[model samples]
Target: MTNAEPPAPRTVVPIEPSLLIAEAFNQAQVTALRHSVTSCSHAAGLTGQRLDDFVLAVNELITNAVRHGGGQGRLRLWRRPGELICEVADHGQGISVRRLSERARPAPDTAGGWGLWLARELSDTMAVETGEAGTIVRITAALAAQPVTRPADS
Candidate 1:
């Protein structure tokens, strides 16, 4: 068999930087919303494990918005260059500072508090904005694998 060099990575150019999916969802719509996010994210060039991870992260955010926020929330998904971004917002009283500051994984016996942790762990980056009016959680995952650099030997 002849040896072949790997093909160079290609950059993805989004057709429209506008939102791919924007919807208001409640508990009943969570499953459907997840499917839509999967389709849009795959179309935006995220695939395989990366795509799965991003979808899961989005699901967690949505669930949290429903369960803790105010029983309803809004979701926005889009892409920017090499990354896919998703934001979930809810109109509840807002998350407390103590809850927002805890980054440690929950204990095995814990009954709740896994959503935000999972979202943060699965995405490339995550941010939260909260106040008396509402809370918004934004997360992003790279659409392409970043190249790993190695130091030259002395």
Candidate 2:
């Protein structure tokens, strides 16, 4: 057989959403998050309303991983269906759904649990999958095809 190489499994394509590549460190994670959003916006041709949704979701997911996903992780985002899907994978011990639900409840007069809370609010669907590889928290936010209009016209 010839020595031709096979296609790469994890190919980074032009995503309408952002993808972050960084260590498990907090500072790096933060910078990666911001860059991911900008990249996504630019790649997806996002503007105005789309930008708002993407920025909000990106911040929430990145913040959550930094605080709860054990320290370091990798983030990947893409346009799936009509929604933006983000996957934040970390090499932490992993978290239970029950624990996540409890922690997601923000305390009164405090901003601490707000990341998870905001993630849940902005995302149409959220789920956690843990294994020997690590834990990957997936978050998805729906995107409107066109700018939503207020009522008034018949």
Candidate 3:
């Protein structure tokens, strides 16, 4: 007999199918996923400066998923009332939260190290879920209330 505890239950977030984009991204499929994410974002009514910001932030995360996240992952996008949500998940070793924020900004000459930081800065809110099995980053950008325009009267 030996002292041992039961394994903990997993905490992977379930993707909402109603608004899901790409279910998985591989080395050859990243471009398609990017297009899907942007198209969904556009259809969700993201536009102008806010639209560009959201795309940039999400692109960084996708790049990280390809370069660092075992060269494959998943991407999803959806609309939530006043916000647009994007989620990227990878089946690779996780990075600690502390390490994720080590630098405020990378040096100009530095080859890289700015993906996660930029995501947090650009998105309205971001959450990170990581473990030995995988990592998922969910980011939200508040949708600017579209201006109501009325027809001009003679």
Q: Pick the candidate with the highest TM-score.
A: 1
lDDT tens readout by residue for model 3, 1-154: 9778888998986566448575787779867777777788888888887888888888888888888889988887877768889999998888777867574777878788889888888889989998888789999988878888999998
Q: What TM-score would candidate 2 get against the native?
A: 0.62
Superposed by TM-score, candidate 1 places the C-alpha of residue 98 at a distance from the truth, in angstroms, of 1.1
Worst 10 residues of 1 by lDDT: 13-22
By the TM-score metric, which is better: model 1 or model 2?
A: 1
True lDDT of residue 16, candidate 1:
61
Which ten residues in a row are the worst by lDDT in model 2?
Answer: 15-24
Give the alpha-carbon lDDT of every model.
0.93, 0.66, 0.83
Q: TM per model? A: 0.82, 0.62, 0.79
What TM-score does candidate 1 get on C-alpha atoms? 0.82
| Best model per lDDT | 1
RMSD of each: 11.4, 9.2, 12.2
Q: For candidate 3, what is the lDDT?
A: 0.83
Report, for all candidates in order, the number of backbone clashes. Answer: 0, 2, 0
Between 1 and 3, whose lDDT is larger? 1
Where model 3 places Cα greater than 4 Å from the true spot, the runs are 1-20, 146-154
